[model samples]
Target: MLKNSLNWIKKYKIHFIVWALFMLYETVVIGLLFNLYGNPIIYIAHYIVIVSIFYVHANFILAWALRDKTNVIWRLPFIIIIQIILYILLNYSADLILIGLNLIEVKGKHNLDSTFILRNLYRGIYFLGFSTGYYFLSNFLSQRKKTEELEKEKLEKVIQQQKTEQELIIAQNAFLKAQINPHFLFNTLDFIYHKVNMHSEIAGEAVIRLSQMMRYAIDSDEMENTIYLADEIEQVENLIYLYQIRKTNDLNVYFSYTEDVKHLQLIPLVLLTLVENIFKHGDISDDDDIAYINLSILNELLQIQTVNLINHHKVKNTTNSGLNNIHKRLCYAYGNEVSFQYQSIDQHFKANIEIPVKLLKLPI
Candidate 1:
């Protein structure tokens, strides 16, 4: 406790010295006004008792009292009464010290008295007012400083938030560019495969087919809405060839397309998604199940059909999911000009799609 008090005094040493100097100046001014000089020690003792009482009540007692939530307004009476008691005690102690030190002339009979009580009471109000005003002003300035700091922090947070959002947009654009560059990447792969073809024909051929499929994906997603029908068919063919190499060699997968595709323009990836969905959901291992893919032109309308035995339930999940994506994209491109039919019968799933080229509306 003594250490804490010493630390506190050290922290406020400047305040204490300044206040003491102010009291001393007031004392000297009062001596000049009265045109009389008492021993400086007597005045020093006098103001010590008075200033200590009032400043203690103001700085320490009231600081604690006011921050309390309950009975705060009612604390005025209690605080005043405590200060009055302190004032009486401090004055009485000063008088005794004066007489003991022979600092003041003792002209009266030796009778301890409360004769100074009324005068001190009158002085208490002025001292209390000064202390109260100082306390309130200090509190207001402290609160203003805190409010300013809070506003500064909020402003910094806003600026940081904006910077973060800008970084996110840049990252998103970079990600889209990376996603849309597969065509360039696949072309590089094709170049590498051609250079290696002199060493290994089978490896070079497989690499080229994979390159074609990757290029198809990049072109379908990043280029114009409509692509040549031949491009889409070639992607389906590459995908099937890659699958045949990876899957069982004895797998019976049939693919047929009419010659009309050479002159037609079709929505990109329509044929590829259909063929991929078949491989993804079909029972290719069972020799008894049938799987077929066909594309034809009838009455100036391009038609595509796929049938596969459904073993997807045991290995992959493919219940109309691929169909949904195709349906949504085709509907957006061709609207009611597109016809789609899908069904499951006798452990087999079939999908048929037809679109009239004459009734299409192309995006600008």
Candidate 2:
């Protein structure tokens, strides 16, 4: 009951304000009329009762008028006519009682005539005006509320769709990266087979290193995001060994740790991509033109620097797909915390990458 009352108040606050104004008008009329001739206390009491009756009448009329009962055309006219008759009858009965009690005088110098029919006509017009205004106002407010709800729902749907698309893109990129290691493995194995058939003694060592590299890749592939830095370094070392056996000249691989990394981790093969790029693009066949890779942690930063002798005389074709993939991975992993750059100078191709050491130290 209390909830319903509160809801009604909220829905009809303006109507209540109008009714309050009418009550105040009635009170003022009674006060002035009483001060002029009758006792003020009696006049106030009589008008209070009259205002209470008017309030109940107005409330009931409005309730029935607004209700979705039958056809509005039939219901509205019936409600208005019935309420007019009821109001006229009640007011006339009260007026008669007041006259009999001598609380109101309708004779000589002080008179209050019972004009029931004329009062009813005026009251009916008042109710008609109020009801018409209320109907349009309520409809406008309700439609505005509905439009706001629809806009909220549309925005929510758009946000959900964008979230789904972003997830799909992340999944697709992961799938593509997953394909890379296997393809690299197949090519390396083919090279190993050719070396063995040619009776190269280094083929045996290459097979051992390849086996370890394959084991690390397969093990790390099961992880969705990251692996320990120690494990990643181990895999890179094995790949470097394999690359050394395949290349005719010297290629140097160096790894250093300035900070404890038993707890450090990174996405698998992040550094390996840079290493692979070097082998693919840099000249490793000349002793004087050695390829060098250095990885270290210092000042809470993981630094990876690679300098390779660039054979400008040879055909230079480097696809950006691998770098783009790494860029995406770094963005997803470190956001703005990681920095990457590559430069080509007089005879050397260089890449320098710095990633926050805190990322590496996080427990995977």
Candidate 3:
């Protein structure tokens, strides 16, 4: 108990110092104004009670009343009235005790009458106003600090994004220069796939899926700013199928989509990147907790959402660069018209993306 008291005093030493100075100033001002040198015991007791009321009202009662809730209008005033009544009664009780013990002298019987009650009531309201102002000022400064922090973060992100974009441009140029001829690549894959099929059909099917995914990647570069959304969805389906083959169809994952969204055009590779992140960092083998991917158009906006249980073992070694890349591309292509949000909640990794259907002409 003694250790806790020492810690509390240490933490609030500044507050103690400020209050002591304020009390001294008030005492000196009263003495100079009316030459009324008050009883030390009475002054100490009164100041202690007022200080308690200040802290309790600001940090407890007012904080509770202002919390996000319903019917705050009636609740706040009701609580304030109750506190004022309690304060008046407490002051009256304290004075009666002091009078009984002869620790203080009452100059007149009026001190125990309505006049005294009214004075205490006014003091309670006065301190309550001070406490409320303190709470609002503290809250405003805290919010200002948070806003500044967020703006700083945004500035740092913009710098990092510019760097990433430069690196991406260099990487894309290198990839194009090093790429093998499309004709030679497809021919070789087809030939090998036929020979493999003669031996093992499953192995041949895997090669076919691989070839298709490669073709989509290469063709997306040759296409204009946008491709049919159906083409992207098909590649995603093929990728999932390839994973299913690898796991011998043991994986528990579902992909759903509406027919209308497939025909619409949008940036290529965004959905594919999201799905790849899932496969790289998600646990898809749990039968009781299946992963899900959904695609649809809502109110003229294309929506893509994915939810999966995180593979803790895999996530430890993984980075979210893939998700960040998707965000960069979408923001570049669609600007503020696009929305992409992802987070881990309740042990489940979830991502949601929405873009206006009209803004499908740009590329990333």
Compare the candidates by lDDT and give the number of the best one. Answer: 3
Which lDDT tens digits does candidate 3 get at residues 1-364? 9999999999999989988998899899989998989677777878878898888888889888878478678879998998888888777777777777677777765255788878998999998999899889879999999999999999876875465444434433444553777766666667666766665666667667777887899998888877888999989999998889868899998999999888777878988998888899999999999999999989988899999999999998766988889899888878888899999999999999999877763344
lDDT of 1 at 15: 76
**How do all models score by TM-score?**
0.47, 0.42, 0.50
Would you list the clashing residue pairs of candidate 3? none
Q: How close is candidate 2 to the true structure, as a TM-score?
A: 0.42
Count: clashes, candidate 2: 1
What lDDT score goes with residue 26 in model 1? 78
Return the lDDT, model 2, position 356: 88
> Which predicted model would earn the best TM-score?
3
Candidate 1 per-residue lDDT over residues 37-72, each given as its tens digit: 778787778677767866787678788777886877
> lDDT values of the candidates?
0.74, 0.67, 0.83
Rank the models by TM-score, top first. 3, 1, 2
State in Å the error of residue 6, model 3: 99
